[model samples]
Target chain A: MYQIQTPYLLFLGDAPDQLAAKTARGINDWRPEKVVGQMSLENCKADLGLPELGLQEAYDKGARTLVLGTANRGGVISAVWMDVLKEALHIGYDIANGLHNKVNDIVDVAGLATQLDKNIYDVRHPTEQFPIGTGEKRSGKRLLPVGTDCSCGKMYTSLALEKEMLSRGMNATFRATGQTGILVSGSGASIDAVVADFMAGAVETIAPANEDPNHWDIIEGQGSLAHPSYSGVTMALIHGGQPDAMVLCHEPTRSHMRGLPHQKVPAIKEVLSLATTLAQIVNNDAKFIGICVNTSQMVARDIEGYLKKLEDEHGLPACDPYSQGTAKIVDMVS
Target chain B: MYQIQTPYLLFLGDAPDQLAAKTARGINDWRPEKVVGQMSLENCKADLGLPELGLQEAYDKGARTLVLGTANRGGVISAVWMDVLKEALHIGYDIANGLHNKVNDIVDVAGLATQLDKNIYDVRHPTEQFPIGTGEKRSGKRLLPVGTDCSCGKMYTSLALEKEMLSRGMNATFRATGQTGILVSGSGASIDAVVADFMAGAVETIAPANEDPNHWDIIEGQGSLAHPSYSGVTMALIHGGQPDAMVLCHEPTRSHMRGLPHQKVPAIKEVLSLATTLAQIVNNDAKFIGICVNTSQMVARDIEGYLKKLEDEHGLPACDPYSQGTAKIVDMVS
Candidate 1:
């Protein structure tokens, strides 16, 4: 797992400010101190809760990396962005890109980086080959966040759990599977983009053979079992993650599934049963430890009531890991 | 849509005998009259309820087409089989191939067909392009049979329902989505083999412009919601089938999700809720009309007890669609 060697600057070029750049938003929320400050396009600038500066100035202010914070379509870097990168390279900062377009693929940038002796970390590409899963038992603890639906806060739940474990001085690593999570953690694949035939094999590459049985690999999950288009990636993760335990992530007040009004959200108990049965196929004892509710839509008063309701009904710990933290939920497995 | 223009000879060359030839088995069981005879290697020969004969001899016996009856891995054709096809072409048999290898792609065979005026129906390839799903409303009733696990008799349930509809003199057609169904119908894409992105689009093509308000489109389903490796294809089908009603299929005696012993089979009520919530996302009024159980594993007495218990529990209707027939189940939808 590659941790973002921080104090890095958040770059929001021409993107709408505040959570608009999902990659930057994730990094900002998860590790605020690693983000020393912010850089934004003049037209879309807003309060990033940090001082704004140019690439070179930000580097001088202890930003060691120039991370391409926007998820551009097809990862195509525009000519203007190329010039900004060249200038950043001159400022002696390393490059971190999580796009399909590799930084090393650009000849001019590669030549300059070779000249300057700075590394270009292309995070999406895997370093080692992994064979297809034999459903073999392996060492180490694996925790995966299964969700009720897409965008139900699986990533937030996973990151919170990882942070909770790390803060408690235990060894835990967040294994990213999506582009945003890959950018935040600096390793993993855009699993949904992989071909159906090799989806399971690709998942195996991210989960390494481990020596520490207590070491936790909290994997980020993709699409929902309820979602009609993207569930294949989700299944690969269940079989591939071989999670010893899982946390169910969901948004409480969302009446419809994300982007599909005709589809209703899956029942929480139903999704719990679904994920548990699916994961247990890979590991017989695999269990869903708790629930992570995305109560961002709920009002302050309703939040406590909803959490308690889920807890009382399911008889499992439930909380908005972002707002209430994952301490109690993490206790189930830790 | 493309029902096999029949009186074809079942060709099983150097392949395992019996229903082991999935495509052959489907055609033999569902539409047996179309298969005039069979061809087999020395090692694996079985009675096809018709006389076994050589290529020319079978054609002489009034067979117009030679349906490639085995789904080979990677769809590779051995040299001996190529020779057999060449000889079958010489004997004036139109070729119907469902393998990934297009009969038209084989140069000499395609040239021979052009000269002989014999058509090669590459059943797996789509004849026309289809756009991605818009979730648009269309006329007529579409009933898709969803299952608790793959090969949980989803195909059998769907075919039985369609047969019931047809016997009642209602306008109905069975939409094939897997390789066996494609061979049996001479239409439809093996959806799992389709690239993940266009799965829904492929489904849309099969279900085009339904004019009759009372017409029934009974589409065959693949995979299971409970299975981890193949749920994405299932979701694509859910959104793509856009069915107005659905039937849940289950193999009652099976202990776990197919090929996955670690995961137990889902409860019927849970699968009902899962499919209902999922299909309703496509068509809000979509209802679970019936349950189709595969009681092939059960003895005669146990079948009645199981069906009665389920009917008492759910209260809509339940039966072994193959044995008791889909009359009661189809009546619910009709």
Candidate 2:
């Protein structure tokens, strides 16, 4: 709901490892043109391989926003990072934070930013009030990447689809629904952070009616319809977006759900079937166009065979979007 | 999560009609023993037929709380009613409010209540943090009354089931998931008020696993799974409650979802099949024991024939719980 200025200085605040700064990695990977340079503390291990820039240097480089893109344990913004944040605000950089701890809620940092008339956008929290979803059909085409479980490449698949569509000069826009996606795309709300009643409405807000009928809104998905803990959020996204086409995203190695050890990840078939059933509640023509797998844990030699097997069984395009690209899936819609 | 001390003075503040005071009517109808007396502003047109009592008199009559149970336009707490609320707090009464405007958010009222050491419960907002739902099966049984559309008698059916089960000396508790139900039962969370990710978790928190194997938590439902605006909330409730038994609640005369004139209600068969399928995702043995219809608009002569048709078609007990009671349906689970 908050407008974040572009040309960001990505900050990895003493991240213990590269994985800890995956948020930064995602933004740099997806939107390199938006990055002025990277900034980090001495102990930080992560690197985006950009020139290290100080607050003033980054500001001078035309960086309008300072993105705290690293995540630490507990997702809290450490007190040690305050000086850098304050300096960035003073140097005319608005802050965009994706961490659980909000930059807007920290008294000193917020007060200084307020005094300087700089905006602090907390990407994890939605600041806008959304209406209750009306279930009304909107104009334009939508494609949502639903998942077999949480964190199973839905965003990656969506982004890939958007890129492929754009590369072909097809009208497409990647709609972000989570913090990393929001940071990468520079817009959209964190759907999970919205009030329960307004989850669908938030989706509707983020991906509204478009004038172009051929335009595709590549809406990123969260959680999973098969996941007990997060199915509600998934359902909201499905109903709100009312996607014309859905792609099932899965992580092959995990036997259970993301956090719940007792819960098994549903089979790809089950997810696709369920996703179609639910999606069709709003859009009767909704159909599954592909299956996107996170085959990072799979043996390289087996990836092709596995994908082929899935494709054969489900009668849909199957691929690891990061590895194979979404060209095959995009071909169907384009 | 705030505990509202019982024996309430139901305040219907200048309600223009009985419908505006339906919340007060609900509390009185479901939990009459908790009502000490009724209070209203001078122009109030609704009555519960209970003795009128002033703040001090109600307190003397064993009322520990004043329930602002009437709803006006915009659900705002009228400025004219603040005096009575303040006086009630001064007379040692905690306030239970279901209005969209919160009692705790009103600085003067909140400040006075803090000074007086009395509680102000804003039932429409959830105050406690809920963990994400784990698909792990818990002990005890839960029964949910799902609807074909929002406000189609799910709450009434659930309450009826609880009352019938209790009268039959069965172990049952009404788990409220909305403000009206919360006020009636004096407990449970407003599921829709929870953060999107925690909707299921809120339901899990409200209908927790009980030690008694025979104990049935009759969880009140919200929204319809077929509803475009609110199916997300419904999905969360279904997954979180993991209900062992369910009842299909419908208002047959309605052609579309509540507040959405463009969206038609799903068929009764469609809703039942969908409810069962979704419910069985967590609890494999989950089932629909009956159908509860709100037949208030139907002619008396057609009621029996309509119910018979539904029962014959679905092979489940069908009844208007308000008119016929839930005895036949209760027998299945009891």
Candidate 3:
């Protein structure tokens, strides 16, 4: 339910195309046919060679929806974009925004969208008021990706693990907690955007309450045990997901914490100790299964050596979750 | 700003005198003059040793306010209590509550309070929206008391540290984030009651921003790094407090995590590592200065030997913040 219907138009706005535009890039790569065209007010973002058009013109060309494709730092939509959003809604286009700022929180836009019968999908906010978590053990198999720092390949590791488990004919589903992951899976709450006290509760609701031994919930993690600003989200997931096992995700080439040059990634022993101790609070037997390396930053020649080095250091099978796949990691899960 | 003014009566309702009524106990202990009498429909909570009467009767005897002193589980007030609250307010009693349920959210009660000019202090909710934490280094020294789990002496350690520091002529303040603590200090938003995204921001504001080499902010910790239900609160505090030093608080005799018999307390070394690692996320130079033990459950004979053993094992000074003192801990802080 994260995405709007097909025949979608991408809106990058006046900003230059960058990593912040990752949502648009991911949608184009994953579901290109659904995308009708790219609309940009500034000169076309070079890499997205798709022809650009204004909102109304793009709508006439079979675009049924307008997706806010860029991810802003604070997750807020700029004021200048209000005109475009209102115009798009006036023309009967449903809008989808995957940011911390919900479109419905904007008074006028929500009113117009409701009046015009266009839906506003705020992918992050919880749809239901969840009861507080009980710390009660439930029956199920759950695997959560634990990373050394934010953006150190948690989503990549989780998706790979799900794909690997499915290839082996096991019943596994990915439970996402971030914008990109929710977009990829089509369902999942944005855990970081949730209210603080109910984070664990929101996490507990993403999957079935009853135990199903044959089913595996591969929960996607947000932030890290080492990410200062967002580790609260990580703690909530670790507790709420109550994973039977965890895959340690690490980016070998980064010397410091992501986006923070002054701070360093915790030593593997420390991160593992912290993650496991927190997880054990709910599930006493929860354990770390394997290491999923994000070695994409390394040259191909050095990637294998680094992964092997990790495997040797941690006494666990380690490989690039994306390039080498997560078969080795999945095999270690109970 | 958290407490109602002087001449307030405590409301325990049917709940018996217990540790859960710590808010009432704290008020009676810290500000006896402000507490006029105890109001309970059930048998009087003998522990309070105060006069008992109905709403109007208590109000007639210099009780100008009603203090919701019992910390209810899940922080929700029962519906039956509302009629009583409304009646108390109608009789000119200002209301003060330190719970997750905001008195202002109850439309009828709020409307009545406004009309009667009776103040309703919902102490747990943040007074204003807080900005995202910067993780930028700030002036003045901060010492945070981290615990093995919730109710494991974080408040006691912080208060003891502040008292000890003041005895030694250092300026120190106890920042409260819970009901009992707020009732004692007369300020501080409950970090747990805040929306998840603003927990850290709320912490940052609790301390002064300007550089004061001589002053210290003894920030109180909530929840635990190992508490499945409330670790998000712990993480937010660790990051938001940005403490230069932390004191590990533990109840040595407790074999299991608080209220969680299935989970064991983390080993001393593991707890220290986890705490230092999480704290280091916000301040690279952050370090654990000492250990503050909550030995209330310990037999007197075992206290000295246990403290010595902990000091030897952790390579830091250790003592019970209550029975002993935080002098050893305060000495280690800047």
Question: Which candidate number maximizes TM-score?
Answer: 2
Quote each prediction's TM-score: 0.72, 0.98, 0.81
Q: Which DockQ-derived CAPRI band holds candidate 3? A: medium
* Arranged by DockQ, best first: 2, 3, 1
- Please give the RMSD of candidate 1 to the true structure: 6.3
TM-score order of candidates, best first? 2, 3, 1
Could you give the TM-score of chain B for each candidate, in order?
A: 0.90, 0.98, 0.86
Task: Compose the digit string of candidate 2's lDDT tens values, residues A246-270.
Answer: 9989889997888888777777877
Better structure of 1 and 2 per DockQ? 2
Worst 10 residues of 2 chain A by lDDT: A71-80
Evaluate all candidate structures by whole-model CA lDDT and list the values in order: 0.77, 0.90, 0.79
Please, what are the lDDT tens digits per residue for candidate 1 over residues B110-219? 89999988878877665544454545567888888888888988888888888889999999988888777876666777776554445676777787658888888888
Q: How many residue pairs clash in each candidate?
A: 4, 0, 3
What shift in Å separates residue A291 of candidate 1 from its native position after superposition?
Answer: 4.6
Per residue, candidate 3 scores C-alpha lDDT tens digits across B12-42 of 7756557667778877865677777888755
The number of the candidate with the highest lDDT is: 2
Candidate 2: segments with Cα more than 4 A from true spot: A73-75, B73-75
User: Which candidate, 1 or 3, would have the higher DockQ against the true structure?
Assistant: 3
